[model samples]
Every structure is written in C-alpha cells, then in structure tokens.
Target: MADPALSPSPQKHLAANDVVSCNKKSIDDAENSRENVAGETALVIDSAAERALCRKFDFRLLPVLAIMVVFAPPFALLGKKIGPSRMLPILMFSFGSFTLLTATTHNFSGIFALRFFLGAAESAFFPLVIFYLTTFYRRNELARRLAIFYAASNIANAFSGLLAFGVFQIKSDLVDYPWRWLFIIEGTLTVLFAIFVFFYLPKSAAEARFLNEEEKSLAYHRIQVDSSSVVNEAFNLRESLQIFKRPSTYGFLLIEIALGVPLQSVALFLPQIVQRIVKNTIQVNLYTVAPNITGAVTLLILAFSSDLLRIRFPFICLGFALTFTGFIIYAAIDDVERQIKLAYYATFMMTWGTSAPSVLLSTWYNNNVAHEGQRLALTSVGVPLANLMGLVASNVFRDQDKPKYAPALITTASFGGFGILVSACLGLYMVFDNKRRDRRQGVKLSARDVPTSRLRDGPKVDDFRWFL
Candidate 1:
C-alpha cells in the first residue's frame, strides 16, 4: 500500500522498533505535559443528547431516598445470580417488562413488587460506579472525581422538585399516571445507561485506551509507592473479609451511617413535606426541587474544601455540626412557615456538609488497611450498612409529626452530635497513632503502602498521605 509514515491510519506503523521508539517519545511528552489537575473526560462524553439524558437519567432520589424505600434490592440479588456484567441486559429487559406492568398495576402488592426489583437493580449501581471510577482516575485525582460523583446528591436535591413539576404536566397525554411515568421514564434511562456502561468502561486502568506502556507503568509506580497498585490483578475473596479486623474500617462505616440516614429525610420526605404546605400533589412535588439545588451548591463547596484540607475527620465533624444546626432549626421551631423554610435550609446545610466524608473516610480506611480484601470488606459493609439505616430513617417522620417533625428532627440532630464527637475522637486518635507508629519499627505509613482502591490509582509519594 503506502509507505509507513504516509499511511492513511497513523497507527499502521506498528513495527517492533517503532513500538519502543513511540513508547519512549510518548513517555517523554507525558512528563513534559505534567499532571493535569482538571480532568475533562467527563466533558468529552457530553453532547446535547448525552447532556439531556444525563439530566433525564439524573436518578435523583435513587440513593438518598429511592433505593431503600423501593428500588434497590432485587437487582442486587440478580447481580449476585446473573453476575454484574450480565445483570444490566437482564435488568433492561426486566425493567421494561416491569415498567409496562407498573403502568397497569391495580394493587399495592404489585406496586411493592415493582419497587423491590427497582431497588435491587439500583443496588449494584452506586458501588460499581465508585469502584469503576477508581480504575479510571489516579489516586490523587480520585478526590475530585469522587466529589463530582457525590455531587449527584446535591444535583438531586437541587432539582428534584422542579423535575416533578414537569413530569406532572405529562399527566394529560403522557400515557401513564405522573407517578407511573416516573418509573417508566427513569427505568428506560437506566436500561440505556447500562448499555453504555457495558461497552465503554475499561476493565481496569491497564486496559484504558489513552495510556501507553510507559505511562501505564508510571501510573502504577506512582500509585504503588503508597497504595499497593495491583498489576494485572486477580480477585481475592479471603482478603475482602479480613478488612473487618481494622478499627478504622469500622469507624468509617459508623461515620457513613451518620451521613447517609439524614440524607433520606431530605431526599424522600421533602416532597412529602411539601405536601403538608401545598395541597396540589404535583405542585408539592415541584416544590421539593428548589431546596435540593441549594443543597447541591452547598455540597460542592464542602467537597472542594474537604479535598483542599486533605483531611477527613475535621470535615466529617464539620458536616455533623452543620447537620446539627439544621436539625436544631427544625427541632426547636413551632411556627409552620418558619419551620418549613428553616427545615429546607437546614437540609441544604446538612447535605453540603455530609457529602465530603464518605470518600475521605472510606479512602482513609482503605489506605490504612493494607489488604485488598480488607478494603473491599470495609467498603462493602460501610456503604450498605450506611444505607440499611434507611429502614429506620423511613419511619422517623411518622404520622404524628404532621407539618413539623420536631421529634424526628431532634433525634436526627442528636445523631449528628454523636457523629461530631466520634469524628473528633477519631481525629485525635489518628494523630496519636501516627506519632506512636513513627517511633516504632513496622511498615512506615506511606501513601503507596496504603491498600485503598484510591491509592492504587495515582498519588505522588510524599504529597499523598494517609491523613485520615
């Protein structure tokens, strides 16, 4: 055909000599460009259609409220049975089948069944997303990536009410009840996204398209200096179980519970709270959106701050303090107008503060606990257990609370105070332990030595510390 240099496809010149020469030049170029702090891949994926779908598929209350109340467990069980990779296509077909059923279901039990499957499918999602995100970004990069992911809550909070308003307009010719349409539209989007995930997501960093052999090696070495970066890995179930022995692992799990439960109060009940003020079901739904937008902005600020501080406990404690303040406004007030507005503001503050700690804390435990199994065990328990508290959270705003759930707000506030104390104590413990270990003869705590999923990505040796 053509001479190698003049080939139509630039990559056609893959001779053995060229491979090494290209790799070396690529490495040199990479070093010269340096680490790009601002990641723009998320932008690369965005088109008008993708942006609209991202907006439509926003999955607002799925985690904060929807999953436990209705949508998460069935697909999770299915993921166990069908395998995570296989679960999506299965879920897509199943979701479509159920959406049709949900559109016609005439009884509560049928409604409950549909909701259960929805929950199960959703269960596999959040954790997988977090784990998947790690395989793409380096360790130091994770804090920002996680911040963006966690921003979903803020986004949900910021916009849920507004979306409900628009969906309600479809009540006339939308082909289903407003509530039914909620399930149908969201479910369809889920199926579509599952398809995207299957095709595009890299199996691991080594498998990523953009990096070459040397860049991959550099990525591995930078992360491995502290995080125990695996090379062409194997799964280890035994190691996953060993994470339970670490006190820090359990501590972070407890911290997550403190963060996750209050989230539901805002995510699930806010619309219901609007019901108390506005009589129209649709309008009430619409009202729920405004506060969440405010909440999202607040969360962004907290996450950015947490990343900048490079500390977990202090931010966690601060989140608790903000949550407690909000709860106090709700708990201490009697006037309905004041209570509702303050309640919204309180939730906004709580959400902003609460979002930062999970990544920081989970990453902390993951880093401190060296074994892969332990990190997996801690994270697996930490997230679901953090969520399981929703069973209790759902009932906290009982019928007696009416427009002002003073008692529930108070209990939540008390939990917030408990979290603040726990984080403060943990912070002190971390400092003392770091000092004590410095004088001893064991594995010196370094960034690369930390076995967290985050550390296995990328972090400069000295700059990335197991600060938490």
Candidate 2:
C-alpha cells in the first residue's frame, strides 16, 4: 500500500505512494492520473483534437480533423493580416468553397484530404469572431449578439439535416450517391456564401459599414470603456497563461468536453438512432431537423433573457437544466416508444447548451482579459480546447452501445450534470474574483471603474471584466 502520511501537493496531481517509482510505475501513475481526470471533470482531449473537432464543424469527422490540425496556426495569427472582422468572412468563404468541392472526390482519401483542406480554412472564424464581437458588445449585450452569430450555425445544423435527408431521398442513380451529393451541394453553396461574407463584412468596429461613425465610436469606446483593451491589440501568450489563475477556464473547458460526446451523440448518432426507431431513411432524415429547429428557437429565447437580465448564470443554468432533463429521459427510459420520445427530446440539451458555451466562453474571456495578445492567445486555445472534448465523446458510442445507447446516454447525462455544476461554480467564482480583486487592490469599484468598467479613459493597465 502507498504511504498515507505524505500527501500529494495541493497544486500537484501526484500518486499517493509512487512519487519515486520506476519507469513503469511513473507510466502507471500518469495513466492513473489521467483516468482520475477523466473520472473527475477534466476536458479529456487536448488542443489538436479540439481544433480538429472544431474544424470538422463544416465537414465530416476523420478527414476534416487531420486538415484542421494543419491549418490552425495560420488562423491563430490571421488577425495580424486582415484583422478578425475581415478574416472571419475570408476564412468562412474559403471553407465554404472547399466544402462544396468535396462532391467530386473519387475515394475516401480524396474526401479526407479535401475535408482536411476545408478544415484548415474554416478553423479561423468561430472562436475569433466571438472574441471580436465581445469587444464591441458589453457583458449584458454579449450573449444576444453572440447568439446572433451562433444562431447562424444553428441554421446550418438544422438545414444540414434537412439537406442530408432530402439529398439521401434522391434516387441514388441520378445524384450518383445521395451522400456524395450532400457534400457537393452544401460545400458549393457555402463556398459562394463565403465570397459574399468576405467582401461585405466589416474589418472591425472601426470599419464596419453597417455602423455609423457614432455607433462605431460607441462600439469601440464601449468595450474599451468596460474592459480597458483596444480592438487591435496584439496577442499575448504569457497573459493568456495567467488565465489559469482563475479555475473557471478549466471548468468551462471540461463542460465543453463533457458536452462533446452528447452533442455528437446526437449529431453523429441521432439520425442513426432515429433509423432504429423508424423504418424509412427518409423519415429518419426528416425527423433530424426538428430538434435543431426547436433548439435554435430555445437559444434565441435564452439569449434574449441572458442579455435582458444582464446576467449569465441563470440562462446558462437553464440550458444545462433543460439538457440534463433531456438526458435523464434518454437514459432512464427503456420502452422503445418512450426511448424514442426521450431521444428526440435530447436535442434540446445539445442544440442549445452545446452551441452556447463557445459564445459564453468567448464572452467570458473577452469581457475579462484586457490584453489583446492574451485575449487572442487565450481564445485561440479556448474554443479549440473546449471542442477537443469531442474526441472523448466521439468514441463512446461504439457498436456495442446499441439501441438506446444506454451507456452513452447515461455518460452524457453525467456530463450535463457536471456542466451545470461547473457553470454554477464559474458564475459564483466570477463574482468572487471581482470582490477579491476589489478588496485587495481596489480594482473596478471607484477609480478602476473609470477605465475598466466604462472604457471612457481609453486602454488602461490591461484591466477588464468577465462576461458573467
């Protein structure tokens, strides 16, 4: 047995008895520690996996993931060239083109490489956009505005299901394989849309065509007023690392991972699950869109409430709560009839909570961090890090996890529960973090509020607020 007297350091994750163990023992300890993290509440995957998962957001899984890993660094630094505002459209358009072209592939490898290319192109926008938008919007305004952008994705999700179902409905001969047509047509349209976004969208708050000079000034000034960071600040690796001083980042990341499998559970497996219940592939495809549509509406409603109340906790909590109940139904129900009903309801959790977190994390980080470099570097990792959990969730639904996929459902439900707890904890911590900072250094109350909360004084000492 291991020594109980010598406890591991509070900050260090160490084996109780094997501090000086041999190579095998070290490996065992390391494995055990990882298992503990998995069992507890760590984001199970790493950066590359997260980016791959995110990059694959447009395309399918395996091929897109490989491509995204290749493409990530360029997107990470894209702001230096065209800026985040301009880069978003440019990247999206690039991705759309590649995705559309995926129709002509002759083999799996061809599809794989092309999807990879698309992955590279699509990798730049989502995380950075959240960062950019949060700069112009206040914490109160963050979720709703973020939802505006995020809501675009819901359109894609809902439409993709319909498109897939419809395409699959085609007499396989004319389309030459409906699944292939699905890739080709969607990819092509996205490509064209990319061009439109690239040309029309603004470069930043300063340059947005839709905003009047007054609005631009107000937009730029408002964020600077509240956060004490400029729109065009450089990326900071060191300061981003300091975000670890706050545990919420990790907490959010864990939520992202836990939610990953469940969301994917639905995305990757939902149609298949429907097929098990319904005989017609057409019916399966048609039914897929319903949840996303409902989810999109739920998100819009929740987003408005989040902003209206000038609060993050309640809506986020509401999302997880809904998701948890959905998962509970999914897990607990055994009757084929009830299971199918519960499975359809599970979309509420995934479509709503799954998509909102990136927005929340983006808002939370952007609202808090004042250094441009730090914000860039942090968000650069933040979203990809969260999506990385997809790897963990992806593998859970094996062939063995059949019918109800009881194991997967139960596992995802546990994760949703964890997400609820973490969001609660993070919300409380944000309040506490502010109080401690204020008590110790008098930040963000009297004089600090002038620069940090109001943005009227221009950028000052890199102080900012969290979106909570």
Candidate 3:
C-alpha cells in the first residue's frame, strides 16, 4: 500500500481488465454477426429450394388440359373384357410412354402427335374408374370414395402451380428446357406407379389377395346385393346401347353439358384469373395453390356429408349455386385490382363450386344405373362430353377479354344456373315417381330398402326406386 508501483496497483490492474473485457466483447459481437449472416443465407437457400420444387410440379400438369375427344366405347369395352385392374395399367403405361416420348419432340407436329396419343390413352380412365368403383362399393358409399379419388385431381391442380413454379426455376445443362425435365419426371413417376398398380390391384373383390376366402365371398355378395345388377357380367354392346333408350339418359347427358363449361372455364384459365390480382407470374402460380387446396378440402367435406345424409342432388345443387355466385361476384366487380382480397376470395368460391358437382354427378348417375355394362357406356360418353366443353370455354375466354373476362364469366355463370335448374327438376321427378310407385304398390319401400339386384331393369321394374 505504501509503494504503489511495487504493490498491486489496483487502478492499472482495473484498466488492464477493462481492456481484456472490451476485447472479449468485440470478439463475441463479431462471431454473432457472422452467425447471423450464415443463418440468413441458409434460410434464403431453403426458401428458394422450396419455391423451385413447387414450380416444377405445377408446370408438368398443364399438358393435361390438351385432351382429345377420342371415342371411349372401345376402351370401355376393353375394360369390360379384360377387367379395369389390367386395362387401367395398360392405359397408364401407354400414356406414360407417350409423355416420356414428348420430351424428345423438337417440333409442334411431333408434340401434337404425342399429345393426341396421350389423350387417347387417358380418355377412358375416368369412365373405367367410375365403373370399377361401382363393382366394389355400395351406392351410399360411392360419393365419399369418388370424392377421395377426385381430391387427387384438385391437389394436383394446387401442386401444378407450385410444380410449374419449381420446374421453371430449374437451370440445368443436362436438359435444354425446363419442360423436358417436367415431362421426364412426370413420365417416370407415371410408369413406375402404373407397374405397381398392375401388380397390386385385384381384378375384382373375389380375386383380392388381401382377403381370406370368407372376406372375398362377403365382398362379392355385398356388391351383388346392393351395387351391381349382375356381378362380373359379360360385355354386350347391344345390351349396353339400350341405356340410351331411357329419357333419363338424355337428361343426365344434358346436365353433363351444363357442368362441363364452367368446370373447363375455371380449370383452363385460373392462372389468367389469378394474374389479374397478382402481377408477378410466380406470385400468380403461388396464389392458385391456396384456392385449389381449398377446393379439395371443400370437395371432401361435401362428399362425406352427402354420404352421411344419403343424398346427392342437394349437394350438387349447392355446388352449382357456389359457382354461380363466384362468377357473378367476380363479374360484378368493376375494379378487381382495387378490391384485391374480394376478387381473390371469389376464385376460392369458383373452385368450391366446380369441384363438388363433378364428383357428386358421377356418383349420382352411377348410383342409379345398376347394370355394369350400361353404367360404363353412359360414363364413357358423359365424362368425355363434359371434357369436350373445354372447346367452348377456350373460345369464350378470348384474348381481347383480358383482365375481367366478363363475357366468359357470364357464360360460365349461365351454365352454373342451368345446372341448378336441370338437377332440381330431375331430383323432383325422381321423388314424385318414387311416391307414384309407393301408392301403386300400396307399400312404402325406399330405394335403400330394395336391393339393386331386384332393380336391374332400372325404371321399367315395379320394385325400382331411383337412387336420388
């Protein structure tokens, strides 16, 4: 204490410690700054990768819109002859091969030929699937099952946007264009899946390997009793053609015509529609994702509810109403850019409207038709006929109609309104006819009370009640 220099020298010691502390603090700050920069960079990379993946998936699906109106009867007949389990894989493999070959196309003519074959290959898929499901599930159970199947399409629509986004971002030396990669990836996946389905799927419930002898017998019996007029019936073209003689067939086809227009309108031009709200192409693709997802979710909910309630027409009508409202809302708005949120919400309504009706309508007609061959015949025509309306949608949404596309929206809305009217009339007719049968028989027997095995002749039979 007396000799400060010789002693501890507290002030000097404190100063030295302060300098050390300052150095440590500076080092810590520098390390933290570096860590923050690294973290930010990683996050940016992850976000970019995710966007790219989404874009890739989206772009691949656009080719699906270019379907050709090939006659479906031959394929339907083939399905009947070979069974859908085998026929489906063959079709899938053919389409996948064509899709793969499309990647090599250097000119429009080459791509056009591939697209024609692709469309031909896919033409019978939905009709065959509808026919196949009816072979297994009961009428009441069919809607939800179809909903589950159809949900994949809606999800694809959503992912198609993301896929397109992701795929377009692909900068590679291996492939000159991003589209080639899209075709390659989609084709490979389709071929692989086709192979897997070929091995795994049973021709009929009776042939299912997962089932024991008892379960197989039970499944077959269930379909025979409630689903089909004749389980595993032989294909008869003359007999199948007799389905057209029924006035109801004409009515059903008319409804399909109405459904097709709005459906194709939304599906083909959703990107264009979203573009009005979002100026950026990438953002347009991204925005479409939510609406399509919402459509899928809505489709599932309505289908499940329809199943639970054991009704189809009401749900179908509700879907039409939504479509009508969506189109009207969008069309009514003068400045979509000004009210962006509302315009965006209208697109969601449009998706909700179109998704449910397609599934329910298919289920509705299938539920009513007990004969397997006739059911396939009608579906083959009806589904493609609906798809063919895309031509009408394509023409109506002209280049000049830019942003709002008022004329196109109005036309689509008109079709939605027409669907509601047609479905309601048909539903009412079925109800009155059922009542007339009940009065004549002097007994009240609901459609569910009588097994479909008894109603093979459809409306011609006294025991028949329309599965409305």
Candidate 4:
C-alpha cells in the first residue's frame, strides 16, 4: 500500500539475498558431497591394495611349504649323518646364496623358484638346532637355552622392522629401490655369518675345541645320563621310525597343528594388524618393532620360569591362552579407531602368546625324547607339520576378510583353544600315566629318578616315566 518503488525495492532486495544464500548452500553441499565421495574412494583403494598384498604374500608362502614338507625328513637324516654344526653351516650358506640370488630376480617366478630352494635349504635347520642343543644341554637346561636361541629370531624380526623403516628413508643415487638394498645387506651378512659358524662350531660336544678333555668328558656324560639315551648315536632310519608308533607322537603333532596357525599368523600378518591403528606405513613398521622386542623379553621370562619350575605344558597352555584372548579381543572390538590402545595391546599379547609356545613346545617334545635318532625323526615331522599350518593361516586371512579379519581371528583363536585342550589332555595323560607307572612298579620313580642311558627303549621299559 506504500509507494510502489520503495516497497518493491525492499522485497527485491530480500529476494536477491535469499537467492544468493540458496546458491551458496548448494555450492557447499556439492563440495561436501564430492569430499565424501573422494574419501570413500580412498578407502576402497586402500582395501583393494591390502587384498593384493595379502594375495602376494600367500603366493610366496605356497612354494616354501611345498618344499619344506617334501625335503624335511631327508634333511633330518642328513643333519644326523653330518652333525648339526656342520650341516647347519651348509644350510645357512645355501639359503644365503639363494637369498642373494633373490635380489637379482625381477619376476614372480624367479622369486618363487628361489623361495622353494630357500625352503629346501632351511628344511632341517630348526629340528637340527633343537637336536643340537640337546647334545650340549640337559633336559632341564634346554628350555632357557632354546628360549635364548628362539629369542634371536624375535630380535631379528624387531630389528628387520627398524631396518626397513631406515632403509625406506634412504635416498640414494646409485640404488633406486630400498628393498634391493635390504636383500643385498641381509644376504651378505648371512653368508658371512655362515662362513664364520662353519669354522667356529664343533661337530659334537665331544669334539669341541674350546673345551678341556675333562670338560668334554663331563659334557658328553651329562647328555648321556639325562638328555639322550644313546649319545651321538648313528642315524638308523628303521629305529627312528619306531617313534611314530606311539600315541603320544600323534598328540604332539596335534598340538603343533594348533600352534602353527597362530605363530604364522603373527609372523605374516602382524604389520597388517598394526596398520589398522596406524595408517602410516613407516609408523606401522616402527610399531611392530616394540611388540616383537616385547615378545622376545616375554619369551625369556616364560622360558626361565618354565626351566626353574621344570615344567613345559603349563607354559605352552599359557601361551595358547594369551593367543586366544588376544585374537578374541581384537575381533570383538567394533571400532578399532576408537579403542586404538586396546587393539594395539592385543597385538602385544599376540606376540607374547606366539613366542613362548614355540620355544616351550619344542622344548617339551625334546625333553621327552631321549633317543637322538628318534628325537630328530619326531622333530623333522613335528616342526614341519606346525610350519605347514602356515597354509591354513595364508588361506584364512582372505581378501574378503580385510580390515577386521573377524573370521580369521576366530579361526586362529579356535586353534589356540584347541591347542590348550589337546596340550592339557596330553599333559594330564602324562601325569596319570606317570602315576600309574609309579603305582605299578611299587616305586614312585619320577622321570629324573632314572638315567636316560637305561631308558633308551623309551616308554617300552617298565621304569620309564613321562617327563611331565
């Protein structure tokens, strides 16, 4: 009703302001939508990358497993014939040479071939080392010694992570890729170390150059009495095969099956697990270092305690329990980003869980087996059988199970739980069997009560008791 120009001017101003505001809102909404799409695309790309990496790792594992199974027993026999000290050096040198060759390979098939040969070279290294330690250390002393030996691997794992981080940082004019430098460095060091060990290590405790005649005699006598029924016995394939006839051998193998999955899972996928909490690649590698070092420390503690207490299965079970809990906790967490500290802690527990069981389980079987040939036989099968479970690990951590990997976690935990049960049952059976043997003989003779020299027939003798 006022002057047309004045009224219309106010309305027009208000209309223009609304239009401008609407346009600005639309622009902001478009920007936000575009940003969201970009973020989603990044996540998809990350997931696909993770899947590809997992597949590549799985492919690498296949050839190693195949070679290990096919070559382990023959290598065990070879170890026994030549002796661990001498045989180990040859293995070290061969594997190192292969590793060096691996650095030159540009294709997948080349690396695959090298890995197969590398596995062949390393087929008997672990069992031989276990057998080797039994020659020098008594049954009770073996755990801590093996723990120390096993700790080296854990330390190497931690060191490798730190090394990777540092190597990745290196900017060089001569070398284009950091990974090539890693292979060259590791391979050279390994070859050099193998050469040193070949000269340094004694063929047997009896042949040890560092020992006095009396000390050598004492060392040999200690093993003959407590550790081995037949000290430095000749390898007899027929007699060695006798160990497989026992029911306990199968039980031990079952435990190995359970132990291998979790062990390999941590070995293979720990960095990926760490990746959930840490988005940065270098940071993930660094974070893994602490957990591995902690694992080594934990292994030392558990091994020392087990040795002090002179028990094996309890600690092995404890390790399994830790593994089970860690996986369960990690899988149960709905949002790892929010509960990052807890998720990270689970990784520590995973390391703790895996490290001790391997040392203790190896010690367990070695403690019970007194025949040198039989020990090697059992170990050849047992260690490789456990390692073969890497196949299970490699498969279960599928591309579809990316991020949480809930199914893989549950499966691994189930194996751990199964290990706990089997180890406990076997342990209990040992306890009961020992008691029954004690009652039958009318003398409560513990395993230590009898010298292993007379118990060479193993459980066949009436006086023989399980080393519970």
Q: What is the TM-score of each candidate against the true structure?
A: 0.72, 0.73, 0.84, 0.83
Per-residue lDDT of candidate 1, residues 1-468 (tens digit): 679666545455457569889878876754442232112112233345333422322332123212211133333433433343454445554655566567668799998998677555545555544443343333444455555566665575556556756776674664646777766676676556556545543444444454567445444443333334453244555544545555665667677778676766655676665565567876665665655665555556665665565555776687778878877865666665645666556555655555555556555554454333344445556666667767767878888877767677777777788788877887788777665653342234433233333433222222233566
Error of 1 at 93 (Å): 7.3
For residue 264, what is the lDDT in candidate 4? 93
Residue 407 lDDT, candidate 2, scale 0-100: 74
lDDT of all predictions: 0.55, 0.59, 0.82, 0.81
Model 1, poorest ten-residue lDDT window? 61-70
Write down the lDDT that model 2 would get: 0.59
TM-score of 3: 0.84
RMSD of 3: 26.9
Give the alpha carbon lDDT tens digit for every residue of 355-423 in model 2. Answer: 555455466555556555555666666666555666766677667877667777677777778878877
On lDDT, who's better, 2 or 3? 3
Per-prediction count of colliding residue pairs?
A: 26, 17, 17, 0
User: Candidates 1 and 4: which is better by TM-score?
Assistant: 4
Q: Residue-wise lDDT of candidate 3 within 84-176, one digit each (tens)?
A: 878877888889989999999999999999999899888898888878878767677778767767777787777786786688789999988
What are the C-alpha RMSDs, in order, of all predicted structures?
A: 15.5, 16.4, 26.9, 30.4
